[model samples]
Target: MAHDVQHYNLDQKFDFTAATKKGLFTVLGIGAILLIIGIIMAIFGGGHAEAGAAEGHAFHWYQRLYANLWINNVYYTGIAIIGVFFFAIQYAAQAGWSAAIIRVMLSLGNWLPIAGVLMIVTFFVASHDLFHWTHASLFDKASADYDSIIDGKGAFFYWPMAKGTFPIFFVIRMVLFFGFWVFFFKKFQSLTYNEDLAGGTSSWYTIRSWSAYFLIFFAVSSSVAAWDWVMSIDTHWFSTLFGWYVFSSWFVAGLATMTLLILFLKGQGLLEMVNENHVHDLGKFIFGFTIFWTYLWFSQFLLIYYANIPEESVYFLERLSSDIYGPFIFVNLAMNFVLPFLLLMTRDSKRHGVFLKLVCLMIIAGHWVDFFLMVQPGTLGHNGGVGFMEVGMFLVYGAAFTFVVLSGLAKGKLVPKNHPMLEESYNHHI
Candidate 1:
């Protein structure tokens, strides 16, 4: 069958209009207001008194604030890195269908440098409040608060230093991972921008090579990152599937972000070369990975539940049986798995803008809840729920993320004009 190849303006750049900026700023202002209100309520509402009593310790309102910070930190950071990771996957697999939307994927990396700074700074500021192992007494044998399990794992965070002192090794790993990620992002950005001007396949070959290396590094780094950032929050509990579980959640959320952006651009009459076929493939990824994420979640939950090990089962017991978080557990599943699975199952749903948009938004918010469940139970005990604070922080992070990604998108050629497989993407039918 002969296909009509549509020609596109190779030099087209995204117009980062003042109107769009205004809209984003409006969202930012609203988010800021909500955040302030949530803070005031936390201070005056007496919500933490119950939580403190339940946990046998004084739970400060600031701890809940810090937990929210960490939750959005890890959640949005995952979304950002997934962008770069997905871009690399395209080149490594030599996939042609995504060529037209490749730049959209790369734009998410623009948040990485900022995210790295936030992750490090938040860790320093909120370490004691959010991370259990950061308490020096936990590592001190003479202290009543000493933890044998955490002490045994001390080298992972404090090697070359006393277990109770500072987490030199952990900090180093954090720095090195972000350093490498930023380095690679800059490299990819330079090469792709150069490709636009030079118009040759040399950059393509180089990118494929670099993509292979990035994938290799990301495979190891992403897993370790999950263990460090999220799994460690439940200091006493560990899951073999936690890394993949976290990765799958991030992957689906990233896919949703990408789809939403693609749809928004289409509404703006940009990326004319990207058609329903491209959207369908993206939908398939969301659909497939939603199931993948569910599989990982169930595997982790079932194993712990079946083993009935006090150490492992306690993790779920804390959330599942609690009045504060039990409802959210079902909400998380419905939004992340059940809803996306059913909503996106149809071919028409995958191809249509309205359905895709709805599901993408749900997946994005749903995964945030997933992260909320993971972080809050461990850090806030029964203190946390999706209150004004949680909603406010998410919106703040969401607006900032959107602004960064869109600003980056506006700076680049919306399409990879010189990409060798551009024609294949134009003719993509499935």
Candidate 2:
């Protein structure tokens, strides 16, 4: 059956209404209240000192706060960059099925600039509390605190300067990655907006060229970033698959987020060109990557578990044996893998809004837990678990991220009106 092009309004723009702003602010306010309550509880709870004493260190409430910040920082940053990544992938692959919804993907990058600042600031503020390698004494050969293992890897974080000084190399990588990501996001944004105005194939070709370059840069930078940001937290434990593991988690979460947004717009009676077919494609990506993430997770875990290399096995021991985090290991697998696998296996489920919505939301929250598992075990030791602070911090960051993405969406055409593949997207079918 031929679809009528006139049935869709290509020029439609998202209206960022007062009601939407109020709703987001409402969530933000609730998150703020919860955050304050969590902080108060941490201050008065008084068990951290005992826990810290057991571990031979002093603990503060603020360390938990910083850990929460770092978790959300890495989690949301991945989602944001994944948006640009998915957008670039569509263009580079010359995919037509997503042309109508491509704008939703790019809108995610709007959060990148904000994420960059939050990540850098969080690193500076929470370095000692969160990253074990950040300790200066670890590099002092004469100090009892020195770790020869960390010292051997010091160049990864502190090259071109003395070890244990400032992590100039690590900081540079952080800034450089975000800088290039934001640069490419803006480049794509400009080209797309210009294409809408000019209505030519030129912009599409140019974007494809740029997308190839961005993907090449991302392939390298994303892995290095996984090492610099998350893997380094467990300074002694390393995995050959850590980078892929992290990227797959991010990719699935990004897919889920994008699917949710598309559903939201569809419910709002926007994106007329988008239909069940487009949604199914999104669902398939989420389902596929969820398994990919699980594969990497298991691959990383199994190798260490079977080898029983004390250094490698210690990483899993920290989580799997802990009363605090042990349950979440299964929870992470169940949510990210089992549920998504079961819920999305049927073709009808992928095409249905309600089913897709439920699974996507779960995937989004599930991946957050995955990151929490990755960071908190290393940073807070037995001190960390999901509580008011973790929940509140997640809500706060989530609300803020929603605001930025929607604000960007409202600023431009929701559909890429002049995209060369617009007609192909209109006729998209499984």
Best by TM-score: 2
Give lDDT tens digits, candidate 2, residues 1-430.
3357656787899998899899999999989889999999989985455445623688888999999999999999999999999999999999999999898999999999999999999899889888888888889989978899999999999998999999999999999999999999999999999998998799999999999999999999999999988999899889998889989999999999999999999999999889999999898899888888988888888888899999999999989999999999999999999999999999999999998999998998999999999999888887889988888888899999999999999999888888888888899989
Question: Please, what are the lDDT tens digits per residue for candidate 1 over residues 1-430?
Answer: 1134434676778898999989988988888888889889988886555555633578788898899999999998899889999999999999999998988999999999999999999999999878788888888889878889999988898999998788999899999999999889889988998998898799999999999999999999999999999999888899998889999999999999999999999998888888999999999999999999999999999999999999999999989999989999999999998889889888999999998999999999999999999999888877788888888899999999999999998887988888989889988997
Candidate number of the best lDDT:
2
All models: lDDT?
A: 0.90, 0.91
Off by over 4 Å in 2: 1-3, 50-55
Judged by whole-model lDDT over C-alpha atoms, candidate 2 comes out at 0.91
Model 2 scores worst on lDDT over the 10 consecutive residues at 46-55
Stretches of model 1 off by over 4 angstroms after superposition? 1-6, 49-56
TM-score of 1: 0.97
